[model samples]
Target chain A: MTPRRILLGAAGAVVVVGVLEAVSRSGLVDETSLPPASTVLKEAGKLAVDREFLVDVGATVREWLLGLLLAVLAAVPLGVLLGSVPLLGTASRALVELCRPVPSVALIPLATLLFSSPAQTNMSLIFYACLWPILVNTLYALRDVDPVAKDTLRAFGSSTPAVLWRVSLPSAAPFIATGVRIAASVALVVLISTELLVGGDNGIGIYLTETQQGGGRTDLMLAGACWAGVLGLLANTALIALERVAFRWHAARVEGIA
Target chain B: MLEISGLGHAYGTHRVLEGIDLKVGEGELVTIVGPSGCGKSTLLRCIAGLVPPTEGKVVLKGAPIDGVPDDLAVVFQDYSRSLLPWLTVRDNVALPLRRRGLGKAERRAQAVKALASVGLEDAAGKYPWQLSGGMQQRVSIARALAYKPTLMLMDEPFGSVDAQTREDLEDLVLQVHRAEGMTILLVTHDIDESVYLGDRVVVLARNPGRVRDELPVTLPAGRDQIGTRADAEFVRLRAEVGRLVRGVVKDSEPPDATDAEDADAEAVATAVEEPAKK
Candidate 1:
């Protein structure tokens, strides 16, 4: 990002905060119902050092990471298998279409009953939610691999697996990285949603629920959500940085085309 | 050695090639020239064992072609797409060497040697996308050379480059052909390229493409673009091939001025129309 763009973004944020603060101070809504931006920002800052809130953040981040890792481990191979083998892709097309659209949140009650631990429940939901984006991206990326590149390897007498390793996998990697970034965001959302709905012992979602119970503290609830947004922003920025470093060749070629 | 007889192919109901018969001795460089839609590439693909012939068979070294042979390589027209962008030039060349049961170090050494042969050793550490179009094509050629295949197929290998680069690449092919002494079957639509680069030119006619004529190039082995292309024999052969390619000589009738025996040395050297300059 350029300095001017960053300055513009910060300016936009300041305007938003100013507008929210003005609306709250003018009594457009009761303070109890809609906390001022300054009060929420203050609570959010204090929660950064609060030990109890730190534990909740740790719980949420841990679940999100582990679930996302598992999804990557499972879904990438599955996508490659299906993408490389047309017969398998055709055989499973209907099944994939059937399962992909069912919302993971709708499975919360079933997951709570199935898993003995709340952590397991949260992880399963997050894993399910994160799987599709990574899998679909991998599938399409493999489809988009240059046919001439594959044929060049084949004409050199390279076997199928070698072609996959040397050509298709590397060609698909940038798209797969994109999928992982999307999945990271999805995983965090699912983790928080599960914790809120299932009432986990320690999580950002659980803390928000407790704030609601304790006299409906709008400031604390908003602060907890603000931290969630910051976590997502941090994760996205880190993943983008990783992609830029790892897929520099992809970036250069894309720039050349543009 | 390679032998193809009665080879034909069709996509569904659209027949692209039919009743083709050709042979190439070991260490021979043969080029196939045809007009567009003549299935020249399809013929190469059949010989490469990538697209199985719908009619007949290809036999290489006494073994019938099945899948892609164990000792074969192809340089495609679209070099940018043929070379992997993710790998550096050296690694792209080295990747095919793994099929030869070579270790990583051996592969790297062989890849570097091949790149050096193409005068691209300095580009070995750079990604394919980092190089210019001609350099990328050289990388693809280097990849093919690194494999040390018994048979190399090229489908319009220089079709994408500019005229200057194309001439340079043609000389490079001649140099490598002399050094390697491997069998090569190249397909192209450029009639001049066919006569300039081939030991023998096989011309094909379109509409269910089939072989129309084969002319042995009598040009000297050590050829330069300017001197060889301007030679009298080169001019005569090019005109004849152009006429054959354009269907000027009817399929049933033969040109009366030329005979098959001692034709290169004593064919009608005079009264031949010069081919239009490019």
Candidate 2:
């Protein structure tokens, strides 16, 4: 990241906090319902020291990571299969269309009923939400592979599998990385939301619910929400870093095109 | 040695190649030239076994090729896509060696040697896209040379390059062909190129593509871009090839009296003619 970008980002953060602090201190919409920036930060610091709160954070992170890995492992091969075989892609389009729009969050209630365990329920929803983006992106990326590249391999007497490994996968990697990045943030949102809806044993959303139930600790509740926001931001940043490292060629290509 | 007889191809209802016959002798450099859309690429594709011919077989060393052969390599026109961008230049050149079960060190050594032959030893660590267009095409050629194929196919390998680069690449190819003694079949739309690089230039007509004529090039063995172009024989051969390629013959009579004989006679005559002596 550049110094200029850091300065701009800091400025944006200050403005957001300043506006929230003004609203809270100005007696607009009840300060009790919405805590000020300073109060939220203080409570956030206090929560950081709480062992129970840390446990909740750990549970949420574990579910999110595990669910994401499962989704990736399942989706990538299937996506590659569909992408390579045109007939299969055409046949599966109807099924994909039907399933893609069915919200993963909407399935949370059904998952809750079926799993009989809060952790499983949250994991299942995270898997459901994250699967389609990775799968669809993989499919599109493979489809978008340069025909010239495939032909080059074919002309070289490469077997079909060799063509897939050498030409298809490398060409489609950046797109797959993009899909994974999108899924990261989405998986986090789904994990926390499922925990909030289905009442996990320990998670960020469950922690927020406990804080709210205690009453008059609006500051603590806001602080927990702030942590979730921070986690989401961090996930995006981490993925961006990973993308840069994993795909220097792709970045060069993007720079050349620009 | 390679031979193609009555080779014809079509895409659905449209015919691309018809009644095409060609022969490449051992250590021969045969260049195919025609106008755009004359199925020059289709001919190479058929010969390379990338696409099956609808009506004929491509026999290499008396064996018909049903698919890509073990001892063959191709250099496609689009250098950017021809190379695996993810692989380093050395790895790209070394890929064919993988099938031969060579160890990693041997493959790397051979790849480096091939790159050096193309004057690209410094670019071994670079990706294909990282190099200039000319350099990328050199890498493509290096890859083909690295394979050590008995027969090499090039499809307008210099078409995407600038004129100076094109001349340089043509010279590099001629040098490699001489050093390696590899039989090369280069397909191009450039009349001067076809005459300049080939021992024999095969011309094709459009629509249902067929061999219009195969003109023998009678330029000196030692060729330099400027000196060769200025040579009387080179100028005549270029003009003859250009006219034949454009289907512009002043007389309907065949240029060579020997062409009146059987197909085999024509093939033998071309195989025997030293195009450089006229």
Candidate 3:
């Protein structure tokens, strides 16, 4: 955007921080419970270099990336199968509808019982949460591919697989990228939430749980959450940049459609 | 090199095309003109193996064509839909070459040459959407030309462009046909277009589409819009084809109109249209 817009955006953040600091410091809220904004900011800064916190960050990033990658692997092919084969999609519709909306967090009991390890449990939870967006996006994108383009390829004697590979896949790629970007956020949420609730062996979520349980360090809990939010923002920005660079024409087309 | 005999197609219980029998010898440019619902596009689809006929079959070069033949290319009317928007103009042209097992360099080189042929050399790097309607259709033509297909099927390929662009595209096809002698079958509803492009024009009637008449165009080759269209032969042939497509004729009108009117009605029940033999 414009430099003025960027300056205003930064000013907006400052105003928000200024208001919170005022409220927290004026004794409007008890410092023992709220822990002034400055205290939280100081904890967040210190946690940036804290090796334990760094490890926690690394663990969460690893789980988020791994879970997202696994979801892509499972969902893309399934989407293609269901998207390309009408009969297969019709057959799977009932099962997909039944399973898609059930909150993934509710599956923790089943995952813990089935998987005997916490890492597996975290992976399963994130995987379940990330799968729907990627799969559904892929299915719809493939469906949205231009039929005439596919027919043109076929008229040149390209087989069904060739048409899919050459036309349908590339056409659906931008949508797939969007799905991945969305899933990156979803995976992070599920990862951190599962770690918090289940108290995994070592994770940002578990670390946040430790901060609260070990004498209630609310600042550390908030700081850790702040770091998680930063990571999610950074991941999404990178994925969006990747999508722009790789699919410029698609981006233009999407904007036109929008 | 292409033969369609007793070809009929019905989508569900609704028959769209029936008894469509025509043949194009090697190097012949045959155009089909018909009313809007005459299933002209469906006929092209059947010939290209995009759709199969329910009645008779399409035999290309002595083989019963059940699927899209390896040496055929199609230029659809909707260039926005036909040309892959994600690909640059050059890449879209080169895409059909992938199945031919060409290397990257060769495909690019051939694609560039094809783009040059279609007068789109400078547009190679641009996306199809960045260009005007005419240029987008040119990219579609370039894609078809790059394939080096033995037979080309164009379904109202210039229908979306402006009149000037349409005429230019028509001339480009003629120039390409003269240069490569590629057997071509073009379907259009524009009566003048059929008369101008084809060595022979096949006209189809609507309501379970069937061939109405086949008129051999006798205008001399090396045609241009100025000299060729003004020729008396060209006017006669255009009106004859117009009569066929518009379904307006009267044997009592005049000597010129009567000749064309007499050619219709009984255009049915005729299988082998030996215009040369007649």
Candidate 4:
């Protein structure tokens, strides 16, 4: 991006923040109930200084990462199997459709009752939320692989595994990356939501609930929300960077298509 | 040598090829030309081992080909999908060599050599989508050349390209054939292209894809696009091949009517000359 574009984006962000600040300060709404940008920023600064906030962030990050890794381990191979074979894909579609629409958050109550531990419950919810995108994306990507490329590999006397590795996997990689990126933000949201719902040991969500209940410190609560937003932004940006670095060809092709 | 006899295929009761027979000698270029939807591609697929013959078999070097053979390579019509987009041009050319256990340096060297053969050496690091349609097809051809197969099958490889690029690719194929000394079987719907490229052009009739006729191209050994097309013999062969392809005969009868008309025409002409002399 050009520096001019960057400056324009920054200007746009500032204008939005300025308008929000003006609305909150004009008494159109209760400032205490919905804190202004300035108050939230100040609280954010204090939270950054607090070591407890760092620990809570660490716990959420650990759970999110562990859950994401587990989802990948379980989803990728299964997705490939479902994608490669037509008959199996047809047989499994019913089961996938059955499980896909039931939101992961809806499973939180059952997860809490089953797993006596808060961390396990949170991890389970994250896994549940993250698996579908990864699995579905991978399956679609594999299915989208060019049949001509597969036939070319087959013409070279390549085995089934060889065709999958050399043609299907590489072709499907961009879609898989897209899925993972989506799942990253979703996993984080589910992780924090699970903690907030189930009353975790120490998480940003628990801290927000505590702050709200004690003195109705809306700024502090908003500060925790701000951190969640920042985490989500950071995760998305990181995945975008990884995608650009790893699949430059795919990115260039996408830009061309666009 | 490759021999295919009694080759028949069908897709869920819609028979495409039936009782088709073809024999290709070593280092010969045989082009199969037919009308659209005549199952020429199906015949090529059966030969390439990508599609199985429902009844007969394709024998390669005296062995029945049940699947794709190691010594055969195919260039598909859709060049965009034939080459893997995720790989660079050089890597795409070098892909078939990966399982051969060639070292990285050797693979790159061979890929570069192959690209140079197709006049695409500068495009080694570029992705397939980075090149034009012609260049991408060249990359696919480079890949086929790099594989160095004993036999190469091309299914309307130039159909998707522009006219100018089509001519250029045709000449490149001729050059590659000269250099590689590999037998090639090309399937095309373009009658002139089949005559121009093949040592012997095979015409396939529609509605079961039986062999219509086989025309021997007796053009001079060396050929250029302009000079070859301008030659009298080339024109005559082209017309003859075109007539055969369109199912046109001098007798104004169906092709299966046989050569009895030719003998009858000769007898009538002799009788007319005798009357003129009297």
Find the candidate with the highest lDDT and give its number. Answer: 1
DockQ of predicted model 1: 0.68
lDDT of 3 by residue, A31-135 (tens): 767777788889999999999989888888888888889999999999999999999988988888888898889998899898887888889888898899999
Alpha carbon deviation, residue B163, candidate 2 (Å): 0.9
TM-score of each: 0.92, 0.92, 0.91, 0.92
Tell me the docking grade of candidate 3.
medium
Candidate 3 ranges with C-alpha deviation above 4 Å: A256-258, B248-278
Q: For residue B70, what is the lDDT in candidate 2?
A: 79
Q: Which candidate, 1 or 3, would have the higher TM-score against the true structure? A: 1
Tens digits of per-residue lDDT for model 2, A1-258: 899999999999999999999999999868888878989998899888999999999999999999999899988999999999999999998998799889888998799788988988888888888889999999999999987778777777889999899889988988998998898899998888888888968999999888867454788888999899888999998889998998888888779889
> On residues A113-150, what C-alpha lDDT tens digit does candidate 4 reach at each position?
89998999988888888889999999999999987889
lDDT of each: 0.87, 0.85, 0.85, 0.84
lDDT of 1 by residue, A1-258 (tens): 999999999999999999999999999989888889999999999999999999999999999999999999989999999999999988988988888888899999999999999999999998898889998899889989988789888888877898999899999999999999999998888888889889969999999999989468999999999999999999999999999999999999999999
Deviation in Å, model 4, residue B262 alpha carbon:
37
Interface Cα RMSD, each model: 0.8, 1.2, 1.0, 1.3
The parts of candidate 2 lying over 4 Å away from their true place are A214-216, B248-278
- Winning candidate number (DockQ): 1
Question: What DockQ would candidate 2 receive versus the native complex?
Answer: 0.55
Model 3 chain A worst lDDT run, 10 consecutive residues: A30-39
Q: Which ten residues in a row have the lowest lDDT in candidate 2 chain B?
A: B257-266
